[model samples]
Target: MTPSATPEPSPAPVLVLMATLNGGPALQEQLDSLSSQQHTHWRLHVSDDGSTDGTLDTVAAFAKAQAAHGRDVAITSGPGRGFVANFLGLLAGVRDDPAFVALCDQDDVWLPDRLQRGVEALSKGPADQPGLYCSRSWVVDQDLQNPRISAAFPRPATFGNALVQNIAPGNTILLNAAAAQLARAAVSAAQAVPGLPAHDWWLYQLVTGAGGLVIWDPEPTLRYRQHRSNQIGANKGFGATTRRFSAMLAGRSRSWTDANLAALRGAAHLLSPESATLLEAFDRARRGTLWVRLTAPSKLGIYRNGTLAQAALLLSLALRRL
Candidate 1:
């Protein structure tokens, strides 16, 4: 993604795609972060999920201003689709020859090296393993007072694990064209499976399930924000987010239930045959047909890998807290 490597007319520009809703509060901070990215050879495409607020107008103005300033920023209407659909639609809309596609959120602030580092990682794998390269993030808030993070990235990830639980946040995802093609195809094929999770997390599973690769870079290259209006669960500190999750479990927050469960089931189905031991344990634990409940500790941790122990720990905590 060097500044001088121009798109040779035959292809579409390397694009940065963002799916935004009522994100007006921190839109400019996101825009500025992109503007300051270390790589300058990319174009920006936005799919607005019908923002009732000034979100759409703000992005329009920002693009226009950037255009006036000679930067490559573009905006488009998203037909009022929700977050997941708009994300899929935006990437699918990229009919142009895309070398790579990066996901951006309107609220998070990215470090300057995200795109550049991701490009390097993808380059190492080549078209053979074109899944996605993602890094961990420093989960923060608007004020950036408290940052909660773990050494989660640069860890082993595959389709099986990904289907069960998302490893990297969406904002840290960067995929090459071949991987993007595979992702689009998987989404189209998953029509039968309607209740999937976030498009970013789902795409990671899809690409890997198709025999692609996922590489983690371990660096916290993005600032993930948490707020009361979060669509899913927010990324508070280990203690804080966990305590809040226990509360949500008590309340049985609908959004969190739908998103997380769908993620678990989907990830479970992606396990390879070689992963049958872990896979069987995960599926049985997740499957509700049985009288028993799942409580596996994921190989990764208490929350990830969709293991029986992790699930059990979560339920145990919830039961105690509730």
Candidate 2:
């Protein structure tokens, strides 16, 4: 008798954490794109932050359809804090599940190979070590037309760069199992602070500060939708960039830095020795005199994205702004 062929072992499952808030306009398209991912072994866990629109219903219907097709899907109410808290809650919900995690936005259209590329990139690294994978994205209008590639950062990503600028966009991020665990451990620390500038930035800080490996993919993987009602739009043009610089001068960036430092200090036990030292020096420089602030960033290796950005940082220091 002919022997029956043995079934192939299934790929490791991935958990996608999507946070939604009034996403009715283009939520279905994003869901459809996710359903089309080449990496099929992914479960989508969506958390809605009290949407007054039909966002939750749309997600619920999508989950039902996916479940009927034998795919794992779930929906839940968010913490009502904000997007950052909503994402943190979802991360906490899957703490011990031992699955790869990807952060998803309700308004972005992921490419067919988004999950596949992330898995392939992460699989090359040491599985036992914490690792984060992030990539560039294509900025598009609401209709997903007129695509423009986001600006590339010439310098390598480091905790130094992460201190002031977040090069990694949340929509294009994927974390290995180890990295996700580290992030979960910091959720309480995040809640201890009054506010977080951005969840992705906090993850970048936590992962890098804990001596984890961070990979930056040069290729674009998703459509970052720009709309009038977006909480944070595709910050691409000169006007947006100038406004960001102005915020630094207006002490908003300094306030964000203070908040991040407080959160990190609360979780000091989790950081690597080197990272702890660096964080301390950064805080000291923030409160130092004009000359100290001017020279301390360079001495401490704290830098921004580009040369112009670095110059602006120095200017902010001289003016006692950052």
Candidate 3:
């Protein structure tokens, strides 16, 4: 008889970090979705903000259930700061395991293939180089019915566009060990800088700026929940797009840009020379006249996804709202 073939070992576990605040209602569904993932080699780390609801109890129960399946799950107190900071804390809490890390929202259903697809795509890059994987998401209502696929952005994820707009959605992100380590270091360095932007946006900038690869998959792998209290949801229809444009006109977008720029500048040591030059040009354009703003961005090769959105950017510059 032939000798028994050696069994293939399981791959490194993907670390899924989720931060919660009063997540009782939908937390169970999200956790169940994770349990159903096709990628079995994974662990969950949840950071909970102080909750009056039964969120912690729900997480505890789910953790106990998952433990029987040989999956590791941990629940801990979140950083007292808001959601963005809470996420940063979770990212920093990851150990030096040379594993991929995924960001999870408190209330979303991951498809069975989400983790598997992310890991497969990220594995294509050199392990020594930083890699980021993000995908579009299916926008769903509260009950997870009538799902509409999110529109694909035509604009590429260049450093110039990354400086101003964050096309990366946090829940859809997967970062390899190298990228996660770089992000942790950037987060630490930017702590002194007040008003840092969202963790996903910052990571997009940091990775692209450092000459790392950011793969944007057109295929979605999760259901993005849209509800009353969504911090950020799928940018889908005309209404959503218009609201974003209005925000730019209202200076809200500019404020976010300013904060992001400050954080980028604070972490300048990590940026590649080309990215540094792009950042400088963006800064100068922001302070220049309408003609200079238009001319400078063109030279820098920055653009938003849609033609209309790109036109709006130019209009914002001309109006001095950018």
Candidate 4:
């Protein structure tokens, strides 16, 4: 008799970290989407920030249903400070786990292949080196209609670009084991600093600063739903452009820069030597005179995405607003 074939082993599980606050009915669709991922070996941990809109009940129901399917779903009380803290706290709790980590949004509808694609892409990199996988998303209206793709970055993802702008959206980010460990180690310092930018932005900076690999997949991986309750909306279209430019002029971008620099400084020991030097240069450039500001971008290789964005960055430096 012929010998029986060996069974294929299942893929390594992914830890899906979601932060929620008053998610209401929208959270249900997001939960359903998570249940339908092509990569079935995922465990979800939701951090709810004192939701009074039945969000906890919704999570409980989803958790009970998923449990029956042999999937592990857990919930924890969030820090109640805000979404940023809640996410960082969730990431901090990921101590020593070997699974890849995916940051999820409470309102976005993920495509079925989201986890599968991320896992496949991250698996190609060296196991010891940190790898961050991020992709474009189809920005849809509240009902998931009127789809529009997010912007594409023409240049490479580097620490320089990350210092001033974030190309990696949080909802679509997946970190391999190495990157997850790095992030887990850095969260305490990040959490200690107040007013830090979004968790995704900090991750981009932290990974690139540490000389890790950043994989930018051109494919759209999820439906980024835009609604009145979105903390951060899609970064596309003239309206979005105008809003960003206005924010830069209003010194809001400057505040974010300050916060990011402070947090990066708190974790300076983890940065690569070259990245450390660049960070110092960028910090000086932000505070130097007009000529230094004008020359900083070319010298430090600091950049944003497109021509228009580069122009805005220059203008912000000139105006001392960024």
Instruction: Please report the candidate that would top lDDT against the real structure.
Output: 4
Write the residue-wise lDDT of candidate 2 on 1-322 in tens digits. 9999999978878999999999986999999999999988888889988899999889888888899768877888898998888887887788555558999999999999999998899889999778889998999988999999886777878888788778788898899999998888877888778877788888888888888888889899999998887777665678677888888878888888888888888888989999999999988887898888999877988888777788888887787777
Weakest lDDT window of 10 consecutive positions for candidate 1: 293-302
Writing each residue's lDDT as its tens digit, candidate 3 over 1-322 gives 9999999978868999999999868888999999998988888999998878999999899889989989889998987788888898898788766489999998999999999899999999999788999998999999998899887866778788887678889999999999998888788765655667588999999999998898999999999988988987677688888888888888887788888888888789899999888888888887898779887768888877877778887887777777
Better of 2 and 4 by TM-score: 4
Clash pairs (backbone) in predicted model 2: none
Candidate 4 residue-wise lDDT, 1-322, digit = tens? 9999999987888999999999988899999999999999988999999998899999999999999989888899999999999999999999658569999999999999999999999998898998999999999999999999999986999999999889999999999999999998788889988888699999999999999999998899999999998889998899889999989988999999998988888889999999999999998998999999999999999999999999999999999998
Q: What is the C-alpha lDDT of each candidate?
A: 0.65, 0.86, 0.86, 0.93
The 10-residue segment with the lowest total lDDT in model 2: 90-99
Considering TM-score, which of the candidate structures 1 and 3 is the better prediction for this target? 3
Give candidates' CA RMSD values in order: 6.0, 1.7, 1.5, 1.1
lDDT for 96 (candidate 3)? 60
- With a 3 Å backbone cut-off (N, CA, C), the pairs that clash in candidate 3 are none
Flag regions of model 4 displaced more than 4 Å.
1-4
Predict model 3's lDDT versus the native.
0.86
TM per prediction:
0.74, 0.95, 0.96, 0.98
Ranking by lDDT: 4, 3, 2, 1
